[model samples]
Target: MEHSFHYLLLANQATVHRQLLAKLKDTGLTLGQPKVLDYLQDHDGANQAEIARACHIEPASLTSVLNRMEVKALVERRTQKGDRRSFAVYLTGQGHSMALRVRQAFEELEEQAFAGVSEAEREQFLAVFRRVYGNLKEGER
Candidate 1:
């Protein structure tokens, strides 16, 4: 099979994700969990639906992830006022501390991924990536 830009893109993404996951293993965080923690770091107390949308995950999948996070003592879910079926999510103290570590780990991983790439080349790659991302999202509502 001939490799194309899409192949390279996905391959790179997989490599980066693998590296981040390895680093996060010590903290007991999985691949997608960091994205949720990062979102809640800024938007603490968001409801599950809001978090699902923000995290680009299905509500059912988010429910599972939140359950795991809760078990890990990283987050808490509270019943929302006037809505028994709804709950607001908040990061626990431990969650907040782990979020900081997650952020640092991601920074280090990113640096490692881009090591030895010149600033100009990095900027050019980013510009191209933005255009590609926009193109892919053109039909998104």
Candidate 2:
């Protein structure tokens, strides 16, 4: 039985995500939390809306994550300068250290996921994946 391309693609993604999540569990972080920290590592002091967009999460969901992280002392939200209505998200020292570990974990997970694939095959996979992404994105327009 042949699996549809979408099914195979999504299955592979889910498997890899699960493995990564498991590894992150040892660090006392979850999938959602690492996403926020990863974004902050690249774009520090971004407002909540910006972080949500970059992390591809909803505002409501991001708010809940931020609240939890604040309680953990992983991040702090401060009013944006000259913008009382907007709050910027900043990683605490602990968050910065955690972000590095999270980054390493993700990299290791990806490496493990593609372990058996040849370099040529990996390149082909990425090219095909990007085409698939473009096709789906274009369809949405």
Candidate 3:
């Protein structure tokens, strides 16, 4: 198969996902859970909508993910001040520990992925990827 942009993008995503899942196997987390955990580590107390947006997940999907997290005793959703209809999400102690694990997994992957790559090369790749991302986002609008 030709190494087209679409093929490379999808292949890289699948490969990375597989590696991450392997690393997180003992955690019993599924595909979307790690992303939410990672995001909530830095943005604890964010609302459902904020989490969905930041994590690029649909609101309905995020709801289910949050429900599972709640079941695992990894997170809590408290009623927001002055907004009975809205809730702010928070991490449990276990969730914080899991977040740290997730961060380490990500760092290990980054190190492996960039092994032997020059700093200048990494910067150039990031610059190009940013433009590619911007182009795709622009197409959505």
Candidate 4:
């Protein structure tokens, strides 16, 4: 009845993600919201389609997340200069600040998670993770 290594890894990831997300709730951000914020932080004024692609989220889901962020005054959506039908997304000053905090929280959480792990072990773990991710994604193609 022992779980496989992959199962344990995935379970640990899920648990950690959930725990960190709970900590972020007070910042008025969710796990998915920060992805869009982080993208916009680096590439401001991106259209929904671009944001969705970069964030690896479906357009529909991105739309919902953007809507909520807009309502919270974290993002602003404006008509594109050439295309009135297309809107560009930008993070407000508040959103930019929150993005920084969110990034810090993620770093802290990761450090806490791997507190006792050596740097060599961490790099090896990341390599294995990337390979596993590639293997799983290859099956869908």
Q: How would you encode candidate 1's per-residue C-alpha lDDT over 37-132 as one tens digit per residue?
A: 989999999999999988889999999999999999999999889788989999999999998888888789878877999999989989999999
Q: Rank the candidates by lDDT, best first.
A: 3, 1, 2, 4
What is candidate 3's CA lDDT for residue 79? 96
lDDT of every predicted structure (CA atoms): 0.89, 0.87, 0.93, 0.86
Tens-digit lDDT track of model 2 for 1-141: 239887887788788778778877777776589889888999889999899878888999999999999998889999987778899999999999988988888889879878999999999999998998889979978
What is the C-alpha lDDT profile of model 3 across 5-123, one tens digit per residue? 99898998898889999999999988888999999999999999999999899999999999999999889999999788899999999999998999899889988989999999999
- Name the regions of candidate 3 deviating beyond 4 angstroms: none
Q: If scored against the real structure, what TM-score would every candidate get?
A: 0.86, 0.86, 0.96, 0.83
Residue lDDT tens for model 4, 8-110: 8778878877877876878878667977887888888999999998988999999999999999899999999877889999989998998887777778888
Sequence-dependent TM-score of model 2 = 0.86
Between the candidate structures 1 and 4, which one is better when assessed by TM-score?
A: 1
Model 4 misplaced regions, further than 4 Å? none
Best by TM-score: 3
**Candidate 4 lDDT for residue 13:** 72
